[model samples]
Target: MIGRLNHVAIAVPDLDAAIATYRDTLGGEVSAIEPQAEHGVNTVFVTLPNTKIELLGALGENSPIAKFLERNPEGGIHHLCYEVEDILAARDRLLAAGARVLGSGEPRLGAHGKPVLFLHPKDFLGTLVELEQA
Candidate 1:
């Protein structure tokens, strides 16, 4: 089952500029500025006490976030991240229920280095689902 909402990912064309604008206009502060090389994204997590907002930008040729932004022009909420208890078990159960996994079977390092896996939105009524370990 899904757990707490980890963060809402938003794809942007530029990370530094977005960070500056957000901080200047909305008084948002960013933390953990990291590059997810495998996922091809440079991101900063804007923390807001109770919740976090992830700003993502393409780092390379085939950045998934960039593609998402290209398709989703509005560039608002990309995916809802829910922390899970067990990623492998979740994947197995989801597969058994006919849900396809977006990445390979192995879980990948996500925000805070937590293991996470994304289920194909095609299986979740068009909402991209993320299963993460607590």
Candidate 2:
């Protein structure tokens, strides 16, 4: 059901600083910041040979990232995304396996412009898992 690792998402309180750290300090090829209003986040992708690193910052006060930042002031890894050949099929399989899918269990447009669904963190060893349609 799951394919290659799509990207690792990190929640950051300061988007600019995180961008600089990855771009200037780490010498990564960073993409322009793209605001994903539907997802309530402003994202910056740091591309690498094997995979990508996603820097996510809250877009509004009510953003989920804002709540995450409230819990973790310093910010940290938010989730791990894996590509899936068929998102709906994957959702059904996860549901049958007793895994809790976040939100409505329907795929939403992700920062990468792909259909994505989030799974409950507790079900995946405390790490939030995101399945993106490949």
Candidate 3:
């Protein structure tokens, strides 16, 4: 089962401007900012009560988010991340339940610097799911 609705990732073309807009105009506070070197993307996390807004964009050609932005203009919501007590357990259950992993099972430093993984949305009925261990 999911522990909490951790964060919602929004793919934006301009990370800085998005940060400014969310902070200055929308009144959100910066929670965590990290560079996902593996994914070739930089992220800015804006925190709100009971939820977070993650601003994601590509830093290089290998970024998947960059490709997503290409097809869809006006950079929008990417995926939903939920906090789980055990990522491996979740993965195992998901696998047994007919879900497939989009990437390797190895953990990567996520938005909050915690380990995370993305489950293939095709297997999840079009909802990209992120499994994160707390």
Identify the candidate with maximal lDDT: 2
**For candidate 3, lDDT tens digit of each residue in 2-115?**
998888888989888888889989988974558878767898888788788889978877897877899766798889988999888888888798878777777677756788
TM-score, cand. 1: 0.85
Which 10-residue window of candidate 3 scores lowest in summed lDDT? 30-39
Question: Candidate 3 — which pairs collide?
Answer: none
lDDT for each residue of candidate 1 in 1-134, tens digit (9 for 90 to 100): 87788888888876777788678788988765688887788888888887788888888898887778888765666777888788888888888988898857789887568898887877788877777798
Deviation from native of the Cα of residue 94 in model 3, angstroms: 0.8
Q: What Cα-based lDDT does every candidate model obtain?
A: 0.80, 0.92, 0.82
Runs with alpha carbons beyond 4 Å of true place in candidate 3: 31-33
Range of the 10 consecutive residues with the lowest summed lDDT in candidate 1: 71-80
Clashes of each: 1, 0, 0
Supply the TM-score for candidate 2: 0.95
lDDT of 2 by residue, 23-124 (tens): 999999998889988778999999999999999999976788887898988889999999999999999999999999999888988877789999999999
Weakest lDDT window of 10 consecutive positions for candidate 2 = 104-113
Question: Considering lDDT, which of the candidate structures 1 and 3 is the better prediction for this target?
Answer: 3
